[model samples]
Target: MSKRTTLQIATYGIVCLAILLVPSFMDDAFILNKYARYLVLGILALALSLSWGYAGILNLGQAASFGLGSYCMAMALKLRTVPVHTGKTGLPDFMVWNNVETLPWFWEPFYSLTFAIFAGVAVPVAFAMLLGSFIFRGRVTGVYVAIITLAALVVVNLLIIDQQRYSGGFNGITDLAQLELFGLTFDAYSSSSYYLIAISLTVCLFFALAVTKSKAGLILQAIRDHEERVRYFGYDVARFKTFAFAVSAGIAGVAGMLYTIVMEFASPTFLDVQLSLSVVIWCAVGGRQSLLGAALGAIIVTGMQGALSESEIFLESWTLIMGFVFVMIVLFLPKGLAGAIESLVDRIIPEDHAVQVKSRAAASRRGVENEAGSP
Candidate 1:
């Protein structure tokens, strides 16, 4: 393999290794849970990178897909804990509190764990497909796409918050039981749960890497660079955009599902506009062009936020500080932190090796002994 490809492989391998060894270095359940949360958020940022950076489709409603996934798992877990004593898996407590005498037809499907798991992923992908059909088919691009997505996110958020009986309203779906697979219950704060998240992150990152290195990824980048030219070349630009949107939504949904399990609840905050914007910022600051960069950026940014917010002095000013940081990153490091690192590494470790010698004779001898001088 080429040196560049070998270096990339090594980078990914090292990241996976770090994820695997992190729990050993820090065993506290609270801290590990926080890191798991960061990883989950990283997956969401990576999702946006696929859609925005590669396909050139900026979606601001990504949280809508995330909420859908959270609700999918939340509904199932909620059902598990409901009173079956009535000879029926009764409605969630929030519903009954709102005088919901009978379970909703849609909620019935979630009673089955298999269906819930499937829907957690498929629901968001289907949603993206439907939205992309309308948006991309109509030739929406650039900031228009972002505006439309942001509008959709608001609509969905309002819908969930207003429908108190079915959705738990502003409180969202909560008090969920643990996820059961193969008769095993996964604990939110346990090591096993952290490992599950780490494995999932690794798998998702590798999958994204594979996608970005494929022929389709190249075409997607081309479309991002020149959509009109791509369309003129007879490629179904809309189809590819829709596919990227769907994949991004699916990954974001996975992040939502993981968040619900780790946090032990799903809230309306998952679908909030602020969160969607924050995710965009994370991608921007991490170098949205690279999947690994975006994911790593998410983790680092979230970690810093947490640490900074905990400080008594910075608690009130963290948001302002964050805004300044974003501006500076945009102005100076336009490619974001990962992109900057990549450039720096490239400079420090030149693609072509450089040889230096203590003396002119030594340098001349080395040059004569080199491949170019070999006979």
Candidate 2:
């Protein structure tokens, strides 16, 4: 095995170990749950890493996919806990308040927990596939892609808000009951929920790492460098872009579902442009090119945000502060904190393999610059 690959394996092993040990070191359930929220967001960053980092698709509507997943899970859980007469099938309270006697056809399927989980994942992937078919096949690239994604996010968010009676409107789906799987209940403030997020993050982190390290990942990177070149070589560039979009959306969908469980509610904010941009910022600050760094960026930035919010002096200005900090990171640490760590590792290791890793990374950086310059 190559030394570079070995180093990655070692790093991932350490991350897995740290995640598994979180419950042991943190006895406070509240803190654990908060960290779980950060991890859930980390998955969103990882999703962006797959599409934006590997595939060079700077999707700005990831919140739409994530919100769809959240609503799916929220709808099911909300259905179970909503007010219903003694002998009637349960329906969301808003429906009852609106004088609707029956469950909506669209929401009827979410009555089953199994279907909710399926829809939570499938809906986002399906949406991405449809959207990507149009975008990639039509040759949309770069900033146009970002604009289209942002527009889509606004559309989804407005749709959810407009149909307040059905979707809980601006308030979103709330009063969710505990998530029960295999006879075990996941309370929002409990260790079980925290572990659930941890395990999901671990599985997803490695899954993304594996994909990026595989032959498919290399080809995707090549497409990112020059889509026309790959097409000239007889490869279907659109298909691969669509696949990356679908996978990224699916992962974000899962994270959205997890967020609902951790927060015990799903709000329109999940689908907001602000959130979509925040995901991009997290990935950028962490090193969008590196999956581990992207995830770490989400966690570290979120942790600091949470900490700052608790402070009396910083509470009101945290958002502004974060925006400024993000700008600074973009200006100075354009490669992200992960890129810096990569450099540090190379220097400290004192191995010839480090030089090879740096050479390959510099080539990838050049590819990114080319993608940016592409029309």
Candidate 3:
């Protein structure tokens, strides 16, 4: 491998090992859980960065996909805890509280862990495909796509809140029991769970990197920069966009599944527009073009919130501070924090002496006429 590639691989290996091993050494479950949650959020942010940054598709409904996956997992766990009924059964607790007399048929499949996993991924990708087909084929662009996605979040949230019969309204599905992989029990509070999440995050990062570096990745970037040119080149732009959107939604779904497994709850608030926007902010702050940047942004933002919320002063106005910081980054460090770091590194690392000598020679030649006037 080239030196850069080898260096990158080495760096990644060291980082993964550190992330995995460090938590095992920590005695505090709370601290581990907090970081684990941050990592989960980072996974979603990384997915967003890949889809929106690399593909030039802004998905404002990412949280909807995430929420769907989470709720599916929670529902599956809830079903496993309840007794199976041959006929009609009462609704899930929140649904019963909402005055529903019967459980919805659609919810029955969730009783099986396998089926729940299927629905968790399938539902989000299906939604994304349907939504993408309509939007991309219709040639939606700029803020229109954003508006449509925001509307989707609002509509989905409202539907969940109103269904009351099927979906646990307002409250959403919660108290979701811990997951089990085959015969082994998965405890969210243990250091092992933290290791699992860390491993999962690493795997997801690899997958995203692979996808972003593949042939399809190049085509997606082309579509982003010049949709019309790609269309004229005999590619179906809409179809590609739809495919990309589906893949993005699927990744978000996985993150949501992990979120529920870790958080042990699902709520309508999880699909809020603000959550969606916050992800975009994470991408923007971390350098949208870099998946690592997106993850870093999520970690930093979550960490900042935790730190600021605990502070006595400016606790209530943390959002304002975050907003100001975002604006400054956008205006001055357009490439985000990751980009800034790269820029700084490049500046600090001096060029070869030969290159420096050539640069000075070229400069002197350009100013040759001024030499006679220098006296």
Considering every candidate listed, which one attains the maximal TM-score? Answer: 2
Q: Name every residue pair that clashes in candidate 3.
A: none
The RMSD of every model to the true structure, in order and in angstroms, is 9.2, 2.6, 7.4
lDDT string for model 2 (69-119, tens) is 999999989877847552336667777676777777999898899999999
- Across 133-216, the per-residue lDDT of candidate 3 in tens digits comes to 999999997679888988988898889888766777777786566788777666777786787788978888778777877888
Per-residue lDDT for 21-134 in model 1, tens only?
898988899999899999999999999999988898989998999889988989888888855444356667788788988888898898898999899999999989999989
- Using Cα atoms with residue i matched to residue i, what is each candidate's TM-score against the true structure? 0.90, 0.93, 0.87
- Sort order, lDDT high to low: 2, 1, 3
**True lDDT of residue 225, candidate 2:** 75
Candidates 2 and 3 compared by lDDT, better number = 2
Please give the lDDT score for candidate 3: 0.81
Question: What's the true lDDT of residue 261 in model 2?
Answer: 99
Off by over 4 Å in 3: 1-5, 82-91, 345-375
By TM-score, the better pick of 1 and 3 is 1
Weakest 10 consecutive residues, lDDT, candidate 3? 82-91
